[model samples]
Target: MSAPTAQRSVLPPRPSYAAVLRVPHARRAFTAALTARLSYGTVSLALLLSVTRATGSYAVSGTVLSLFGAASVLLMPVRASLIDRHGPRRALPPMATLYGALLCLLAALTWRPGAPAALLATAAALAGAFTPPMGPTMRALWSELVHDRALLQRAYSLDGVAEELLYVSGPALIGVLAGLAPPACGLLLSALLIVAGACAFVTSPVMPGPRPAQAPHKRSVRPSGIPGLLAPVAVAGGVGLALSGLDLLVMAFTAQHAYDTALVPWILGALSAGSAVGGLLNGALPWRMPARTRLCCFAAALGLVIATTALAPDLWTLTAAMTLAGAFIAPALTTAYLLADELAPTDARTRAGAWVNAAVNAGSSTGALLTGLLIGAVPLGICFLLSGGVAVGTALVAGPRRRRYADRS
Candidate 1:
């Protein structure tokens, strides 16, 4: 008789989001992580409003925020490197405590009238520079805990959604709190929640600590991980360029048409709403191809759709093109998150995430510079066209690495 043929079991390309939650202590960890990160979305707006209220100059507030933001972006990867070298538990708590304390101090200083804006700005920079690297650490933790590829994808998707919601609601909450309490109170609340949440997350039952004895993945041909690992960082930079340009394009569009500034949010909301829907759908549904190939496909679609922005003659039409373009954003990001997890050196995964984050920040700065030069010189539509071209460039960036990531090994 012929030997029995062997059959390998096939897993779905995507799994239920509930499966991610059902894992031991997954809910607790995810919840704590989410709350800790809410500060990411809330703190900036709260600080901006509070500082502006106290100082009475948008220039001072902008300077303070810019300094804090620049410092935070530059320092985050350093903290993430520490987290990876040690572990979240050892690296997160102490820093979280100190950062949170600094945040409280900044808030207190901002609460009083006649505070020196420059000194407060310097203090804010120091506080934010040391802000605990919670977001990337939680992502690394999720990657470790959710061993199943399918579940990990969903988890990242959920993270993207949570990020969008927090960003939208954070600004609105600051507005509401201004009516009910001191505006700076919202900043203090964000600080406290981050402290509590970071502590709880580390203490969660499923969260892992450093395992020095455990070996890491096979080294890459160069100093980086897989050949494609670094590509996502570049792609992230491109995406950021597109995002900042889009924001500026909206501002110009509003100004050109005499549309109320309040109406700009609706257009912006259309973009974010598209991304949120895409993230939810992507998490729930499996892709037909590998994440890498599918991501390139999404990038292509985003580029092409954004190109249509140049053709849009009205606000509603431009909003439609923007929405279509935004649909690809979260999916590309989710793919990048997963790819970075798969390909990063086990000891540097957190750093990889932080590097990607930094690239995005740097790209935003670059985009603002470009937009400043382009906004008055050409049609706003042409500026979007340039950003779309950047999106297409991301696809080109990923294309060379496609074979490396098709790997289901």
Candidate 2:
């Protein structure tokens, strides 16, 4: 071989997840972000238990949790835009502090048996309103910290896997703590986690510096809304809708088949386990396909798997199908994030990630609501098809149009 050709062949190997953490200050930043994000995982369960215990009314608890979730999910883009405008250092701390204080207030209100349901609901909503946007901020930081495209892909996969684990384990931790102490204690712990984590995270040298103050004479240019973002946002939302519906549908399936309801958790666990494994494998592969194309493929694959699950005659078959469907979840979301990063301007990166995050969450809420309504009135198999159909339809709508537009250009 020629010397130049030999030199190209000997170029350094691709970086691993370990290399992601080894980037200066990456570990500290990542750990702090995870610590704060865990609060999200724990807060819902803790709030549910606390409100239920205080009011002794399932109706009250459900309403309160609904309010909290709505406030948290709906406001993510607004909070993320604040981070984009002011930088994480300036924006995150204030949000975390207020969020923690509200959580603490909620803990106090729910500490005893008889706090008014109104007070509990108000505090919960306020706490959610102030919840910091840790995940988006961390993803944005990752883009800044790791410039190598291959290494960045690994970092995102590791981050997604770790986040999935955090959600799975966080509720379990809260469950144990609630068993040992008052459920209110779990709320307090969540408060502590967010405050400490956010404070530490913002102090990291890897964090972007504050946005320069704008002159009064000139208005800042806002992004022309969500044009380039339609594909990722729609795909992410579709995935969320399908996954969330799968949970309720599985429960309904068990009930209908007279199988043990206890098995639902195990089935769901399979889904999560498959996702974790798939995320790792996705990152490890050296893909020749464009990210947008890979994203559409992943979404389409998930939709097909989920749709096929409707035909499973037994719980075991359903579990296997769901596990297969889960394999595509992380890759789809990760690629959507990658595309969002590519499409967004630098100043709006945080908001772009937040839009995707918000879409997932909004779709999740809608899925659960709609799935709950359809389970009894509609056939179980039809319900599954509907859930899966959302994803397939989204992929079809978003995929070809972009390529056709490109061709015309």
Candidate 3:
């Protein structure tokens, strides 16, 4: 056999998730990030219930949540830019502190019934504005920690799976706490978790210091700032839009079939479980395909699989179909983050990740709103098709083009 053939035949053993944790200080930093991120999972439910109880109005509660989510998602890039400029050690702690204090204040105000609605809304929005960009920051840190591309892929996968689990379990924990005590109690716990986790994360020895300030005249500017990030951001947004709509579509399907609404969680759980499995498998394998190509393929596959969910005949079949669709979710997201990391300038890594993060959140919010409107007006199957089409179309648009622009002579 030739040297290349022989080398290909004797590839090294695939690196395990254990290899990721073995990176020095990775465990502590990752653990801290997860702890802080759990607050995100719990805060929505806790805040919703607390606001509802305090205001005694669903409309008010909904408005408050919208304000909070908008502030958090829309301002993510701004907060991340500060971290990139000032360093996480300096930027993150203050954000966490202020966020925690706002949560505390909101909890206190909601603890007593009849707090002013305007006051509550203002406080929640402020809290969201200060919410630390933990997920993006952690991904940026992962790039710093793992030198090998394959190893970094595994780290992102592990991080994705853990974050998914945190979200799944966070609301369950809040549900239990809500059963025992007031919803504000859960909100208070959220505050504590973020404050403690942010402190721990910043103090980790592996975390890097701040980037040097750029001179005003030396700073580079692109006309459409995020041109390099277009593909990843588009794909990420498409995935988010599809996934968010899935929940509502499933609900409508179950309701039409006269199936118990209680079964909704189990079906959704299958999607999450499938995503977790796919993520683990994606990271474990060593593939020859380039990351960019892999991203396009993963996204296209997800869109196609999700489109098939429109034809499911029953809840069980729908659950299975959704699980299959979900298999591509994490791998697509992992590849997007990888691409973002590669395309971003070193000094603005956090901001780059944040843009991807923001795309997902913005798409999700828009999806939920649009899907809700479409549910009563259009046929459910058609809605599913539209949802999946969003992903497929984005994948097509974001895929690499053959044409290259001529350089200015």
Models 1 onward score TM values of 0.89, 0.94, 0.94
Which candidate has the top score in lDDT?
Answer: 3
- Which lDDT value does model 2 have at 123? 85
lDDT of 2: 0.88
Query: In what order do the candidates fall by lDDT, top score first?
Result: 3, 2, 1
lDDT of 3 by residue, 1-409 (tens): 9999999889985678999999999999999999999999899999999999998999999999999999999899889888988899999999999999999999999997898999999999999999999999999999999989989999999998898899999999999999999989989999999999999999999888887644442123221354468789888999899888888898899999999999998999999999999999999989788777898899888988888888989988998988888789999999999888888767777887888888889999999999999998998888988898999988899888776887788
Give me candidate 3's TM-score against the actual structure: 0.94
| Per-residue lDDT of 391 in model 3 | 90
In Å, residue 129's CA in model 2 sits off its true spot by 1.0
- Residue pairs in collision within model 2: none
After superposition on all CA atoms, what RMSD does each candidate show versus the true structure? 4.9, 2.8, 3.0
lDDT of 1 by residue, 20-54 (tens): 78878889998998888888778888888888888
Task: Report the poorest 10 consecutive residues by lDDT, candidate 2.
Answer: 215-224
Q: Write the per-residue lDDT of candidate 2 for residues 42-88, one digit (tens) a residue.
A: 98999999989988999999999999989998888889888988899
Stretches of candidate 3 above 4 Å error?
1-13, 213-223, 404-409
